[model samples]
Target: MAGRRNGHAGRPRVGVLALQGDFREHAEILERLGAEPVEVRRPEDLRGLDGLIIPGGESTAIGNLMVHSGMLDAIRSFFYQGGAVWGTCAGMVLAASATTGPSQPLLGIMSALVERNGFGRQVHSFEADLEVKGFDRPFRGVFIRAPYFEDVGPGVEVLAEIDGRVVAARAGKVLVTAFHPELTDDTRFHEYFLREVCGSDERS
Candidate 1:
């Protein structure tokens, strides 16, 4: 689906982690789809949101800011309460339970294990048409210093992959992509997150 109207009541209130990364891009996409986008810079900002997005940037920067701002626990509670979370690029690293190389602080909400910059350096960056689950058309995936899932827990379902490597995955209310869908015109992925993951919860 390209977009979904708030059939039941108000639009789903989605929060974008403003700690770092391309958070503004995500906010624009959400607003275009008719969902309320809240920029979350502090723990208080997390209140009264239906879903959240961790955008692509340096994972360490985002993680450190989250901890310093006391947003880590708040986010964990949000995810555990069935609030949907979508992590793009570096966001994937923070969302995963484990990662390749050095260990870093994570939300540890999803069951997936990710490898940071698994797609190689910026010179190796590329784009691919991904046939994501539940979408009829292929989605353009922009991989830039992206990370890929090396292992997934039992409950996790892979959405899209390239060259047999996991690039997108979902588990319960959480969704993650190694590529930056926000950088593209396609709002299908954001639509997918709101309609499917957020569901009918008007407050979300």
Candidate 2:
């Protein structure tokens, strides 16, 4: 999936948080898929990026950086301005409306409540073949110390799940995945994200 059709001019320039996460892999995937992916660190870094990806890592650390660096407010404002966002793993937790964890700052964009490391520890990482809706084949979902959406509201659309739990969802310009789609060989998830969320201005 590709964002927009106005030639490369309309192609989205995506940013992956490089503060402290698996951002390099995500950047590689986004670049390989044709989107201009950049690394984001501070509030100043948010400028010029069409959309952003909060990668999988220590959520609390990312949250601290958001508050200390003013990225939390910046990101929220970005969302209010119709910007597209994709969150993977810990990023999903930060994007959720609520979380069942200790006190920590959050961007809190999506209308979903998440549980941190709800799937277990990093050593418990596992792979699953997901039957994601709107895709032709099963998606190879990689969950590593992942967070899961425990309470999803009506505004959200459960795009992919496992054993009746949400692992990936979408709402308007916001897209999130509890598992790492950037880790898998299949590019369908990124493709769908680019075509649907990033390229959606025309459809709207």
Q: Top lDDT: which candidate number?
A: 1
lDDT of 1: 0.85
| Model 2: residue 62 alpha-carbon error in angstroms | 0.9
- Report the C-alpha displacement of residue 36, candidate 1, in angstroms: 0.7
Q: Work out the TM-score per prediction.
A: 0.92, 0.91
The alpha-carbon deviation from the true structure for residue 73 of candidate 2, after best TM-score superposition, in angstroms, is 0.7
What is the C-alpha local distance difference test score of each model? Answer: 0.85, 0.82
Per-residue alpha-carbon lDDT of candidate 1 for residues 93-204, written as tens digits (9 for 90 to 100): 8989998779778999888888898989899999999989888999999999989999898888899998888999888778899999999999999988888777633222
Q: Could you give me the TM-score of model 2 versus the true structure? A: 0.91
How would you encode candidate 2's per-residue C-alpha lDDT over 18-124 as one tens digit per residue?
Answer: 88878998888888988888888777777766678888888988888888888899888877766678889988989998888887777778888899999999889
What TM-score should be assigned to candidate 1? 0.92
Candidate 1 lDDT trough over 10 residues, lowest sum:
1-10
**Runs with alpha carbons beyond 4 Å of true place in candidate 1:** 1-8, 200-204
| Per-residue error (Å), model 2, residue 24 | 1.2
